[model samples]
Target: MQKGAEAVHAANPDVLVILSGLNFDKDLSFLRQRPINLTFSGKLVFEIHRYSFTDGKSWETGNPNQVCGQVVNDIMSRGGFLLDQGYPLFVSEFGADQRGTNVNDNRYFNCFLGLAAELDFDWALWTLVGSYYLREGVVGLNEVYGVMDWNWCDIRNSSFLKRISTVQSPFQGPGYNESRSHKLIFHPMTGLCVRRISFFQPLELGPCSESDAWDYTPTKTLTLTGTYFCLQADKSGQPAKLGIMCTNSNSKWQAISDSKMHLSSKLQDGTNLCLDVDSKNVVFTNTCKCLSKDKTCDPASQWFKIIDSTRKQNTTKSFFQSKQIAQFLGNTFSYIL
Candidate 1:
């Protein structure tokens, strides 16, 4: 493997030479003993694969927080140690059963996601195929772990994708660290995120990792990165977007709940419009009657968790710079072991 890696670099000095982990593809613990002596600059990367099934002793029945702590320790010791060694460690394979009903898988996945986010590890999710052409003489066998539907038309489990989105992008990677300063206004109902695609586009929810960084100011307004636009609301029933200079009170927001789930923005003349997802999945201001009148009222779409980014962020990458790097790394980051 070393010879092959060296040969690849020798043929193309600018290309990154990736080394797969040894010993059931889970053992990078050997790196603690020695180094992968790839003399090329920015050309050495290590990869490891993990599944919840490998060592799921107490994942299903134990306290989730306790299990998450234990599992994260194991992952750091085994493969995540590479990050400290000044090399990127890619989690090449990690996925769960898509049925959303498996107790073991469901628990293990939440634990896995916690570790991924805390470490800011670059990883890939397993699967895209739902039904197979043929497998062991059986046709149309269902693969519940697949991301696609049986007919390969729609996403099989959107919530699963949303949960994984928080880790796909590097909040803290090699170059930038100030990203911890931003907050992810995560919507719990649709399991999506609030992002501004363009200055003219309304603030909408999409995959969280792919979303842009947002600065929730002390003045109570949201500032979108890579632009001068800030979130603005024109009226009570209208959609919000990146516009206006963010000087008005309508742009300001406050936490109305003790748990900090409710983000209430002020309307003109002193009425408060709570931030909620509309029927179109767009974020806007609405009534906050449930907060005081009905405790059990389903106001989840208006619910958002402002997750403080706890890790460092990769330095700001311009489109051309990112494109150049992507060219060297190829079109995809996910790969099977």
Candidate 2:
């Protein structure tokens, strides 16, 4: 390990140095006494691997919430020492089987997310694709640990990405303040991210208009009208535009306008609510009483079911040699004006 570290420093002293913990025993106390070259550069980072299965079988059968707590404790017990010494810790690889048979993976991830949000560590998921080559043949083949397919083409599970993205990238802002009132819509099974902003203001003539009611019966379509306003932005923030989106499908809520109008409605829950613009504020009235009461304005109220039909095909057989692995990362943004 010291020889490797020395060679890395000899080649590029300025480059960030990372040391990996070998085997299952990761205690690093012995490194403190070694005469290894200590240029004392600030770029040295330590890497570690973690998995839900490492905690024990109890995590697999226990209640999700209880299992999550145990997982947190186990992780802390293993790496708490390094964290106390101010070393930068990276969870280089972590994932669960994609077959949906491991309940512990889900609980472990939820706990990992909560802890990650509260800590300063940086991490990358185990993989973005299924399949891997091994000496004894593919180990965890066609597993769901990957975010995309082995071909590196379409996303394997979009809802999974959506859930992680919410905790990873909570808001979008160039001129807008993220601290202000904002909303996010996430699909846990497919990693799609959407953000919405609502501002307090007086009403005016525009696309969003007050309506008696609306309906979303099969071929039925509805329109909403209201005044749109552009929020004044600070020099550091992105200029804000108002818009609206409508649909029962949480994954594909269509936007009516992009930063163009404020008063607008879309068919949701088989009905529509039209915004009546007034000098004081916009008012919402149901076009159809049945749909109105059911069309919740809260984004969190939306739910999604995992759809296996959306999984992409895996074309790469690299899981055999362990030399080749598929990787992909992406970001998407949608705004409802």
Best by lDDT: 1
Q: After superposition, how far is residue 214 of candidate 1 from its true place, in Å?
A: 11
TM-scores, one per candidate = 0.56, 0.46
Rate residue 182 of model 1 by lDDT.
69
Give per-residue CA lDDT, model 1, range 139-222, as digits (tens).
998889999989998899987876776656665545646555666666655556787554445678886655677777777777
Q: After superposition, how far is residue 5 of candidate 2 from its true place, in Å?
A: 1.9
Cα lDDT, all candidates: 0.68, 0.41
lDDT score at residue 334, model 2, on the 0-100 scale? 25
- Please provide the root mean square deviation of candidate 1 (C-alpha atoms, Å): 13.3
Each prediction's total of clashing residue pairs, residues at least 3 apart in sequence or on different chains, is: 3, 45
Q: Stretches of candidate 1 above 4 Å error?
A: 174-337
In model 1, the worst 10-residue window by lDDT is: 328-337
lDDT of 2 by residue, 170-199 (tens): 232233242332222222222332112122
Candidate 1, 295: how far from true, in Å? 30
